[model samples]
Target: MTDSGPVLPWLVIRQDDNGNRYRVGRYATKDEAQKIADSLDDRGHKQLYWVERIGTPAL
Candidate 1:
């Protein structure tokens, strides 16, 4: 039998009123994070982007 490791989730970035960036959280999938971003925008949040980590992993 072969062992399959856990798939790390995507990282999400969101900015507040003061332009300070913050990480919302990690989601099981990219779609999940997008959904949360949409919800934040609907709630009047600003500058939300799904950050794509490079070189080193976000986690």
Candidate 2:
């Protein structure tokens, strides 16, 4: 089926010092990720990680 809905971008980022290389969560967009990062920073959640674009998975 063809979809006419507005597309939403997504990305994944790994948390720093989490001990799990694959510990990551999906974000609606990079902006969303940045917002989360800011919150984490405010909470003193010091960490480092990466972010990359991901395609919507087919169901």
Candidate 3:
């Protein structure tokens, strides 16, 4: 088995009381992730956020 760190994609979604929601997904490729996020926003889902994790180099 291969060992994987916590350098994977993540999605953060926030919603409001007005029945609004937003989602943001992080991916190796920014475009792909943004697309998904935009789609969710279009569906009238509040806020969308995404973050990419970068691995640190061993000293």
- Give me the candidate number with maximum TM-score: 1
Pick by TM-score: 1 or 3, better one: 1
Q: Quote the positional error of residue 29 for candidate 3 in Å.
A: 0.7
What tens digits encode model 2's per-residue C-alpha lDDT throughout 1-59?
12865444554454568555453566657887677656655666656555556654522
Q: What's the lDDT for all of these models?
A: 0.65, 0.57, 0.50
- Model 2 worst lDDT run, 10 consecutive residues: 50-59
Taking all chains together, the TM-score of candidate 2 against the true structure is 0.43
Q: Which stretches of candidate 2 lie over 4 Å from their true place?
A: 1-9, 22-24, 55-59
Those runs of model 3 whose alpha carbons end farther than 4 Å from true positions after fitting are: 1-24, 47-59
TM-score to native of every candidate shown: 0.59, 0.43, 0.41
Q: Residue 52 lDDT in model 1?
A: 47
* Best candidate (score: lDDT): 1
Instruction: Tell me the tens digit of each residue's lDDT in model 3 across 1-59.
Output: 12774444444444566646454444555566666656766776345434334353212
**C-alpha lDDT (0 to 100) for residue 9 of candidate 2:** 53
